[model samples]
Target chain A: MTSSLVLGLELAYWQQSILRSLGILLAVLLPAGTFVYLFLFKMVSFMQSRLGPMEAGPFGSMQLLAEVGKWIQKEDIIPEKADRLLFKIAPYLVVSTVLLTYIVVPFGPDMIFANHDTGIFFALAVSSISTLGVLAAGWASANKFSLMGGLRAAGQLIAYELPLILAVVGVVIQAGTMNMSGIVAAQANGEIFGFDGIGSPYFITQFLGFVIFMIAVQAELAQTPFDMPIAESELVTGYLTEYSGIRFLLFFIGEFAAVGAFGAIAATLFMGGWAVPAAWADLNNNIFNLLGPLILMAKMTLVGGFIFFIRFTMPRFREDQLQKLAWTVLIPLSLVNILATTILKVAF
Target chain B: MSEFLRDYLTVAIFAAVAIGLLLVVLALGKLIRPVRPQADKYLTYESGVDAVGTAWDQTPVRYYVFALLFVLFDVEAVFIFPWAIQLETYGWFGAIEMSVFIVILALGLLYAWRKKVLQWL
Candidate 1:
């Protein structure tokens, strides 16, 4: 078996695989748990002027665990008319897609699970798979609300997906590579018109793309303002209307985990990713492999905070308004951004 | 296997591991959770009222139109990625070529907008 070095230890391929599997679990669940506790539990409560869950383990820190225990003991219900097979499989597909997206994100210099040439592209592609799961859950449930939620989610996801991809095109043009690590390296080594004090993170050069990407991400995650899919007031949690117990828990985890995954991707593309600026540290130092995950988590928290903040503050958009924003406003603007980026990239 | 294939293999393994973990939790839940097969419990939820018509009714045609537009732009996105990575090499020649491509797609979006197809209702 082939061997690879991790933390200065040589290990066999199988051992490395086991370690990586554990890492994937952490990468997905840790961020999900953190976001749920920090944003969903505490931040939202504070925003609403409440103390939040102070009873559960030191200021409601253990509320998530308590919620999980409550969910596990609840009955797993399948409606009589529901397609049992598809209903059972939907959450698996949704959660697994979120897990798969983390593979392409680089934590440290050598901390990536997969270093594909088309890393960011792979991440984008796998994320859209959740749309299928949403649609399936909607259709399989055989409920009017689920069906409406499913179709709305499908239309919304695909519409916002264009802007998301187009927004990344600007990043790809600036970084000159779709590889996530390569993009981070470019930012680390870059200078702002010969000023090397702070590397030229793409967020400055590609600010329009950054804005469009975040907006698209907001819609893609179906958070408020663009959350027509699961507009709880209207659609009764939308495609998730019929799910109960563990299945609902799976979807809940998938939603927050996706927020983390996309937040990490956004940080990688626009916020200089896992690297400190060249002025601060040498890019080649092996210490990054250790510090990188921590750096990424911090950045992810910033981006996730921004996402959830908007989610809490903003009112939901009407269906027509949501579609109009993606198709008319975001898409055309992203296309123009791409054109301008390409011109400047070639000119300078 | 080649290094390229090995990277993909890791992805496949990770996918399996995710599903496996979920399944383990699910099985444990099944062991603990109660399942009383009540008839009304299995009926679809409709805000505490009986469901009306079947949910398999036809949806609006606007959805299909949006799907078609998505396919068109998705292809454009695919084409743009390769050109993006190699833009430094392609220079103005590549820039002009991609410019023409993006303009055409934008025009299509404009056409959709003018036709009111972009509108949800």
Candidate 2:
């Protein structure tokens, strides 16, 4: 049952746990830092015809470090009227949920933090815990803008949560397993209408579900076009208005880390996770344990880049329009996608 | 301990690690960061204007309604997950049965929509 090993060495469970802990840290922070530097800074700047930070380290690569340095020395602030304890504890809740999400994601055949049976379900369930932290921050801040932003975030998240959950149902039906590793195995073994050249990535068949999932993810992250909660023009950065210094840094990291986490999930679900095409490599080969994380990271970059590209390009959706899109459009479409997938599953 | 429990232990350990890491960073911040406090600085930010009314005022009831709708669908989604995994074994019977279940819920959503419960106002 000891599924993880480095090189040829067999390690004890405590050793494995330590390794896994470090892996989880690397998995979460690397992508968070990558997305911040690549998409948030460099890509957006290039799109806007301006060079982003080039002074930090080779094209502002060290900008994240600089930002961290700057944020750490600043004062941590809590308003006089705020519920001091909840306001202080809120960022922990948000960032921890983001960290918890990485637990279920399979970085390699053996390189998962925790191999839960209900992997995707567990990830989805824990991810929503951030909403509670958000509400707590808003309520405790006792600021009008914070309250409105928090409530709007709650509404937006809940509305999109359905589509997000339902969209995965189509993939679940196709793979016939809720386990993250199992789903990756299915894709690696799957053939598109008897053609096994490219192992069937769910995105080809679950394209509708994929689209819905991405849209819901955008809304969940409160990215543009669905960023009413954090809409600066309106709510003044929403629930985040009251936070400062290290607490604000925690939320910022959580946001990008979440982007990384969701990007990893999407890559696993729609792309063939860490495995190359079955025709190319035997998935059971131990080589995957080494190459898998790198492959997954590349896929995550692709997915994260797309998400940020859309965030920068789209105009913010009106509040009513946002709710209407989730309820009327995304939900129904995802439900229909489930029905179609189920029918096809049975028919075949 | 059972392997199943071990799996969860890893999760708990990771959670602790995450919190520990955050605390370490926060402690580091506390050591280096200056805490120059001013009375005005502690006041709630209101875009350079003096505060008006308290923010604890009543919010729109629409958010509550949406929460109710979310609960209904969220429960439905939970039920769907197990069915989705077991669909192949259940075959057409499961497909048809779940279709009926989904349609019924869809009808509920439609009812809410028609009644304008989903409106943001």
Highest lDDT against the true fold, candidate:
1
Per-residue lDDT of model 1, residues A69-188, tens digit only: 999999989999999999999999999998899989999998889999999999999999998999999999999999999999998998899999999999999999999999999999
Chain A TM-score per candidate?
A: 0.97, 0.96
| Model 2 per-residue lDDT tens digits across residues A25-102 | 976797799899989999999999999899998878999999999999999889999999999999999999988998
| lDDT of the candidates, in the order given | 0.92, 0.91
User: Candidate 1 — number of clashing residue pairs?
Assistant: 0
Tens digit of per-residue lDDT, candidate 1, span B1-121: 7889988989888888889999999999999999888899999999999998889887664678888999999999999999999998989999999999989888998898899887766
Give each model's clash number. 0, 0
Candidate 1 Cα lDDT to native: 0.92
- Top candidate on TM-score is 1
Against the native complex, each candidate's DockQ, computed on alpha carbons, is: 0.84, 0.81
Off by over 4 Å in 1: A4-15
C-alpha TM-score for every candidate: 0.97, 0.97
The C-alpha local distance difference test score for the whole of candidate 2 amounts to 0.91
Off by over 4 Å in 2: A1-15
Interface quality of candidate 1 as DockQ = 0.84
